[model samples]
Target: VYKGLDIVTAKVTKEEQAQAVHHMIDINDPLKEYTVVDFRNKALSIMDSMIKSKKTPIIVGGTNYYIESLIWQTLVDNPKRAGGDDEDSGLDESLIKVRRIDGSSNEELHKKLMQVDPDMALRVHPNNRRKVIRSLEIFEQHGVTHSEILRQQRLAAGCSLGGPLRYDNSIIFWLTCEKEVLDKRIDARVDSMMDKGLVQELLDFHELYNKDRLKKNEEADYTKGIFQSIGFKEFHNYLILSKEERDDEKGEKLLQQSIEELKRATRKYARRQHKWVRNRLVRRADRQVPPLYSLDSTDVGQWESEVYGKAVDIVSAYLDGRAPSQPALNSVITDTRIADNSTETSQYCEVCQRIFIGAQWNEHLQGAKHMKAVRRRRRQEEANEYREAVEIEGKDERAASVEAEA
Candidate 1:
């Protein structure tokens, strides 16, 4: 974001690398593929060099993989290895690289993984070819499964630059929207993209690499990201199939279609994302991960300050070693139909079937039940704060009185 963009280090080119002080973003080109192992390795190297000058690492990203990897490696592993590794450190690097066995096919991949850890092969999916390959590689090089390797890496040595994560080490802020609203947003975003030269870019790139202009199946990789995205694919199909059609008519038809499908697909995607966050991170106690702090994207509106303030609170709580409070993202945005919402009027959330935002839309969200939910959340936060205050301020009269009453 310094440049008002989310261009990651891996996507930049070498020539662009020389223009600014960049790291981690374009270390490899399209000629060379990238893997999570390489990411872990390169990220650590960049972090190490930064710390030598006593600079702070303020990692900010939406990529769960990058964020989780850095947090896991730094917090759980690498306690004693910070000063540099032993002579045998070369073995660790070799084990992390994605290597292949000779004449490797699906069978060989499974067989090799089974040899080291049959349990792992059973747990991992057969079609997860990348993971299966890495499991075998780790086994061959280190005589251990990847999971166990990480286990030992954690145990080997490391001192905490920070304390245990139980102290507000993180605030997993999940931005969300109701299915209908999210879909409309996606459709609108696609319409905006077309206006911003996406069509022209696609046309230019297509002409530059012409093979078959009429081929619908011959989608370029550049368009793959946009096309696979929620609203763009159908619009792209429309563009390709009707190149000679009027742009205004084509856009209107495609946008309407996108509005429908995006809602269905985005709802599913959001559900999956929520499930993953709950299961993989929030539920993993031993992982030192933090609890999620959810915000309805509509509620946040465009209140960047309020959103950022809540985020800062969550982060500071984690850094200060306390659970986060459920701060509101902001006042929610509502449809004009919800203007006269009231208790007897009956409000409903179509996605979750929860009676909500009250009889009047406003009352539904601030109802006794909703308020109770908020109160319960704040109670937990207060308890955590009280405990931490006693620890830090040392036997405050207020804390002592509360403890005595308890």
Candidate 2:
């Protein structure tokens, strides 16, 4: 989304973009954050204009939340309280400003949220400071829990989790590749970026944006804007080195390490995308989801038949108001009873010294790490018991011996 993050994002080349119109690309400053709300509003306007001109707006993106914002009525709008009351109407701006200035941690914000809206707290991870603050803001603004607002929306939409689809006649095309194949492709993609002078690109960007910060001994922040890009942060150590140092053995090693880190991060990101598809889109039975068609793209040689051709045919049939020849992937049956209870209420695991929410707690109980921890604790307890028994027995024997001696 940032302008200067061209190489790392693998953004479409100017020549390719010239071939077809694209929206929401190169629209934000690398220094400033571009939010999902901003993207949704702009994309919706673009889609409206396209639809008015009798054109289909094809939404393509890896960011699932951005796509969700376009497809579902998910964004909550904060309205003013009745009677134009200013006092106690919304989150206190002064307090929030103070917190910002003080640099309040995510845990602090989450604790505050837990006090007011435990349900929302449960849904949002404590480490996700942005969401915790947002939920608090919603509650203070509307005089209702953020979770309650969503619950009402879902109730109105007659869905278990989210509101109804913004566009009823929507179709989803999910291109999938085998995990092993996808990992290889991700590694290859990183190598290709390297060949295209990715290092030089990072060097230029750092010189322009990050040199001053490093000189001032400020740590490179990878949580914000373009800095969050996988390749950018992985090269932080190498990027900070003096030109001569960067040319030395240490620099070469650091560069290699960064490259490998980039590859690993990219692969991990791919796995997360797959997990999101499976959990949020495929297996999710709590909401009204659009018909999804899966296309196997494991073999590039068969791309014409398996992916591109199938996608073209599916869209064509949908445009013609005819059922596609291929069967739509089935959604798991909606179990509303279970869905209602799946609010991810916070559950802490003492054995692991970590918190697991809702389904995660159940999964944690079944996980090997948790089991290992449990066994370790059990053995420790047994050892303590045996030691205590032996100590008591020794004390008794010593007393008996003393009496005999006496």
Candidate 3:
């Protein structure tokens, strides 16, 4: 109430969103599906606008990756620009310029990029189509590779504020407590959420937006990107429960148990998130990226307020060009359950790209049709290996001499 502003609104949606606004948070639709990439941009835009309007933007929410991605994507001359001209018209429009190509031809794309901007091609992950296609788009348009533009864009994009500050800092505050304390807190939180109609809200949203939303497994296969988010996944499970198992007394009990499990899972998850921020975000003292400074969240009087204050402080320090504090989220390595990969008799499927655990994946590989693919790839791999060996051993030269003598 610093400026005496009235209610803020967040979109609440099955057709809306999981958010609520004092002003109103449920404006975005559940079916529409939100993303970190968009959230980062939106947060930055809002912050910038608030500053210009002389308003102190008090951004309080359970947000993290958006903030991180905004900082990183901004720091790098991401989506490097390349020289492109219409194959028909050599004139380069620069910004709108693009050379579209097939997504399936990764090797061709790689070759094209190496010929165009070898440096960028090397740095981008081979399988990262987002980065690869972006790099290719630059070459297809400008005709000059982004590795070519980096030194120049640095001069042109100039001392821009927000997103990229020549340098930036990040701090991770872990609201840590003993396992028992955390479990108690989680138990309480879950009870509160239930009281607040978190379950009801789930039911409402499902009835409203499921036409647009999808199951996690299906979305995960496509990498729709929200499969890993906590709230999104919970919302998805609610839908799954409705679909797979009908609503009944037994179902209600199972759902209630699932809710408890989810609350516990989220608490465990928060700890893991803390671990990731601590580990993945750490930096060497002299590295170009800033280091992380972290502390226990429970140590503060209030967890939310303390975390928010430190995040703002971290952002403020970045804006002022001071060295950022190095606080990191520690590692919580989930996914520890690796299926038994050591079953010596089992085979790997190059086609499905999945390892058979205890003959499950092996069954798919050994199936008559799939085995045909395995046989083909194995033969090709062997031939490729043999050809490489022959080239290394000067067998190509020897073979040429034998042919000439014949």
- For each candidate in turn, the TM-score is 0.49, 0.85, 0.46
Expressed as tens digits, the lDDT of each residue in 1-406 for candidate 1 is: 1121122111344486587666655344221234444566667677667778765455544455556666664332333234333233533544434442523676677666777776666555554566677666656555556656544544542211222332233345666667677656755655555556555554443354335433544335433222333444434555454454626777667655654555466556666666556545544333445555665566555647556677777777766877567642221213121221111223454433453322345765657866777677789889999999877777577688899999
* Predicted model with the maximum TM-score: 2
| Ten-residue region with minimum lDDT total, candidate 2 | 80-89
Which stretches of model 1 miss by more than 4 angstroms? 1-23, 48-56, 74-104, 150-171, 197-268, 300-302, 313-406
For candidate 2, lDDT tens digit of each residue in 182-234?
98999899999999989999989888776666667755666765776678889
Which one wins on lDDT? 2
lDDT score, residue 376, model 2? 100
List residue ranges in candidate 2 displaced over 4 A. Answer: 78-102, 207-220, 240-245, 331-341, 397-406
Q: For candidate 1, which ten residues in a row score worst on lDDT?
A: 1-10
Displacement of the residue 293 alpha carbon in candidate 1, Å? 3.5
Each model's lDDT comes to: 0.51, 0.79, 0.50
